[model samples]
Target: MTDIADLPFAMYDAFTDVPYSGSQAAIVLNAGQLSTENRMRIARQIGVPATSFVDRIEGTTVSLQFFSTVMELPMCGHGTLCLITRLVDLDLLPCDSDDWHNATLDLPKGKATVKYRRNTNGRIEVMLDVATATFAPAALDMDRLATLLGITPDDYSSSLPAEVASADFIHLCLPLRDLDAMNRLQPDFAGLAAFCIENGLETVAAFSTDVIAVDRHLHVRDFCPAVGVSESAAAGTTNAALAAYLFRNNLVKPEGADLFEIRAEQGLKLGRPSQITSRIMVSDGDITRLQVGGIATRVIEGKLSLPSPDSGPLSQQ
Candidate 1:
């Protein structure tokens, strides 16, 4: 059994420049002293979409783990970005040089590396070579899907089709025909939650390429009540899966070779607009890698008193 300790935690709004606009994640630093149960308890206590717990190994490399309100996740893009931004602000990640710095993150998926450099815009551009997204045929009942989305079958895009994709987590991709359909989408939380629990679905990302004028691939909205998020302004893993879907469907064709960058706009309907960029590396007609990059702003800085393992669940704290 490990002893109880008061940990330092910070809140960061990722995928948006302004705080409280993007997805918020709680980060507890130097959390190596906490056990798995303790970590989960702290995350639940935080009661956010996700919580990132980091144990600084040496220099910039560390063991980072993500926990949703329900369970510990394999990887979370927004969580990672929030932690990096917090670290950079705290001087844990040195800057001021033109050379790009690398940090090794030991995640459940694998050892993933994050590269960061102070861009010309004065923002710390952080990018992670996340899980390679893959697609699978979705055999979904149109009626059932429509019911889950709380919309009529005719509202869905007949051309884009529904498909399943995964990078860090599996996502059911629904391409809408226009922004109105995307904005008016309302998921039956109870029904979709039950379906997700039964089928192991992490999230449902709805997007439309018909909204934005130019320089953007799509306007996206995510519903993940299954994973405890009713609606997310910006999601890293979910957007990466969307990028892979676009490439697989040839919606975002390569310039000349098998490479493409997709810029996405999300959370506008929620009033917390976000800018998310994804890079796809393809080879032999297959997506080799997918990476999501964005900016994050720290909102709150303080320490949290974690509950002692002997005292019981943190809900009581």
Candidate 2:
């Protein structure tokens, strides 16, 4: 057994350029040698929604593992962005002569493409190439759904129906009428968690076209209790799914081009106020490419003390 030591870690607020304005994720450096149990223990101790362990960096390929306080995850969108930003900030993925540097991420599900480059102000900009989103109509009762969100059925948007969208994770895509309904959301965390688990979902992505910023496309709030978070400030996968949902319903379409960009505002109610960007490329009425990206600010950098391995095995909640 390895002796207890201070494990180096960095926390970054993802999906935003300013610190403390986005979702937080912890990136544990040099965590390749840790056992799965140890990683889980560390994740629980960190108590973040998502924690990334930097396993290895070989040339242009980076191996990473993501864990929540409850269990291991196949992939994490915000976590990936934060991890990439951390790598760049540490000078591990230094900028070259080219405008952008491309890398591959070794995730538990599969390999994913990543592009990063330093902006004019030298802040690292990272974009993750996510899986093409596919959606299925959800059979949830509108009344029940309304009760779940503490809103009335009349508050739902008449434009789009509820759906289960997938792009690495599953989210119940719900549409609200306006920002007022969004501001009145009062989710039953326990009930939401139970519903998510029963439906094999990760989050309920509530979005509206009524955005505060004129340039933004949607205002979103992600409720994810099944995966251990009550509500996410900014979720990568959920926003990617939201982008596809809009495109599928013809809510947003490209008139003169095949690529349509989607900008979403999230976490405002939580006071984090994250901006998430996604692009969808269409080819002959079919989605061909999907990408989500944003900038992150490093907030806390320090070492974490590992619990004694002999104390007891921590079980997933």
Candidate 3:
């Protein structure tokens, strides 16, 4: 009989400085021996917004898989951020060394890049290279949005207009007017979930570029209960999609500038306020890179013995 091994895991609050705030992600390092079912079982056990399983392949490069307690995802931005930051926090990488500031992620879909750096203020920030933020026209059901999110058409207007934006999966970009409307949101979960199915969408991001808080270029919220994520406190991909939405419309940068940064905030209503910064690299009129990063702190660590092979087939909780 094969021995069931013990799997160790750690949880980190990503995109925020405060503990128990931000969107928490669980990480399982060196999980090469585990099966997909085992990873899914482990993710369900942790009960975080998302859980990542990492299999080390070489120095600064690892194969990663993300789960939402329901199913596996090709990639997850916050989960990736937590893994990169945890590597630094655990001193698994020479985070302070110039040569050790970068890492490559091998996801189910493809390879992604990440860089770690400390600002002049001595705060550590992890930057992801998602080069995949892109946009295409989206056919939106405005009435369904209003019925589910309680946002009247006049409550907000999108400068960039609605579209399917992607850093990972396609997210419907719904630009609102300001933070007040976001804070007042009480999304109808059942209705929203149905909308996602009927429309073949997993998530919709509603945001306001008009800053309600000083220095925050955007205030946003992402809903994805269709894929089992009711809400995400701070999402790396969602913010990247927002930046792409803004950039395509010529919103943030000067006429000829290439590099740009956007300050953003989310999760205020849940009280787990998260701050994220998105980096944009435009080679011409086209954006060549989409990266989002922020501070993440470790909160919990534990180990669990895997289910016995003799046990019945596993199912998500």
Best by TM-score: 2
Model 1 residue 87 CA deviation (Å) reads 1.2
Instruction: Tell me the spans in candidate 2 whose CA falls farther than 4 Å from its real position.
Output: 1-3, 307-317
- Candidates ranked, most accurate by lDDT first: 2, 1, 3
Better of 1 and 3 by TM-score: 1
Q: TM-score of each candidate? A: 0.91, 0.93, 0.90
Candidate 3 or 2, higher lDDT: 2
Question: Across residues 228-270, which tens digit of lDDT does each residue of candidate 1 receive?
Answer: 7888888988888888788878888776687789888888878
Q: Give the alpha-carbon lDDT of every model.
A: 0.81, 0.86, 0.79
146-186 per-residue lDDT for model 2 (tens digits): 79889998888887788988768888999999999998899
Which prediction has the highest lDDT against the true structure? 2
Q: Sort every candidate by TM-score, greatest first.
A: 2, 1, 3
TM-score of 2: 0.93
* lDDT tens digits by residue: candidate 3, 226-258: 877888899888888888778777778643368
- Model with the higher lDDT, candidate 1 or 3: 1
